[model samples]
Target chain A: MSIEHRDDTGDRFGMWLFLYTEVILFSGLFILYAMALAKFPQQYAEASHKLNIYFGSINTIVLLTSSLTIALAVSAIQMGRVKHCLNLCWVTVALAILFLVNKYFEWSAEISHGIYPGSEQLAEMGEGVTSFFNLYYFTAGLHGLHVLIGASLIGVVAVLTAKGKVTSDRYTLLENSALYWHLVDLVWIFLFPLYYLIL
Target chain B: MTEHKHEPVPYRTFIQIWLALLVLTGVTIAVSRVNLGALNVWVALAVASVKSSLVIFYFMHLRQESRLFKICLLVMLVILAIFIGMTFIDVLYR
Candidate 1:
């Protein structure tokens, strides 16, 4: 039945290996998060409770919808619907902007309250609270970096679509980029709960 | 490319997943209100794990991929689970 091509297999394997590196990168931050949560459970719980759940929930929905659009974009490309694919990609990008905007307000509110890493609010809360915010900023800063990068990739995907570089038969780059975007969204899906929701 | 009639994307599937995610989010929020103490954390994590798996399987199309890819991913997952389990045990228990 199925014939295997070494070239295709090799490319896929390489892509997965690269994903492994990404996993390792995020795992480092996760380790720090776990340690901090364990060391300062009360402070961490309090800090988490202060997170704006309305924004957090809305951001999750936005990211989830973006994931769906990107998946549809990939599906369109596979089906040779070039125009549809491009439109869906743009939709995904717009949704990402919505996410970033929500993140902006969320962070701005927290920062205004002086809850940033090593700020006055943290100082008043004492050592554990300070460390909790430290971990909060550190872990979330890295995840924010990832979101920024994913947005850039979204731009690139749009540019490629406009230039007619991505086609049904040659959409590996688009597919892989979309995969990375989904992973970014997936990470946030967990981080929202870990950092904001649970006590 | 294979010759075939074009079909509409699974709009229903997408909507179903959206509803499922919304329901899960509500469930998580409700659970947070109940405060099962330390057990609440585990409950939240369990719910998140389920949500993430649904995303990976349906949203990411992992279930439709080739068997080889699936096997490789499974192996990786098992290893990651072991690694996380060991660390959590060390941190929480020891």
Candidate 2:
């Protein structure tokens, strides 16, 4: 019975431990961002102004909405509304897709203008500007990867919920997935300002 | 199913937090519009901190977690702060 006994709290704590390490991983990039900013403060300001604030702000709202839906999905399952929970989870996933699509268009625009890393255009712009674009692409690319992973995790949770493996009384998986989704949003909350807002 | 009994947050609360987050999103963009000189970066970071706190506590359910979880989070944050401070200090002295 001990082997079969489930400890939901322990499972959650395990998830939190994983989350802590994920935060640490991103902090490493943030440290690099600060170093690069210090090295090329002028290029940082100029490069930021060229970024499309419309895309960044719109994506921020989209991710925030997804966070709300995922949280509500957890609450829905806890209340035994399994269908509602599944629908909310799908809604959250849809928003994640929307966010990624927007990112695609944004990156395409930058690339079309010959703004990508290693391009002759960027090389002509000097080392400071080149470094700024490099950091922007690397940092935002990593964060976008997280959004993709988080969305896939939620999709798995949704499938489990539909099969009744995740339920009102036993929802550690759903909670863990929601926690990961919220963390994705949390990272973007900082990235928005750092990349687009503060010059 | 080990004695699972706890009050789940109401749907309204999540909605309210979502609204607040959207408003903060607007505020951050609006504030960034103004030229705050050297204070712009600090202001942006401060607002971002507040927004993340709301998500961490309410959305992530950190408020309902045990003391150990809270301690772990605090410790992680402290380490992050130390890392950030050391990086800036290194830049300043170099």
Highest-scoring model, lDDT: 2
Q: Candidate 1 — which pairs collide? A: none
**Predicted model with the maximum DockQ:** 2
TM-score of each: 0.87, 0.96
Cα lDDT for residue A70, model 2?
97
TM-score, cand. 1: 0.87
Scored by TM-score, the top model is 2
Model 2 spans > 4 angstroms off: A1-3, B1-4
User: How would you encode candidate 1's per-residue C-alpha lDDT over A47-166 as one tens digit per residue?
Assistant: 778788899889888888888888888778877888888898888888888888888888899899998976876799877778766766776677777777877887897788778887
Give the alpha-carbon lDDT of every model: 0.76, 0.91
- Score residue B53 of candidate 2 by CA lDDT: 94
Q: What is the TM-score of chain B alone in each candidate?
A: 0.78, 0.92
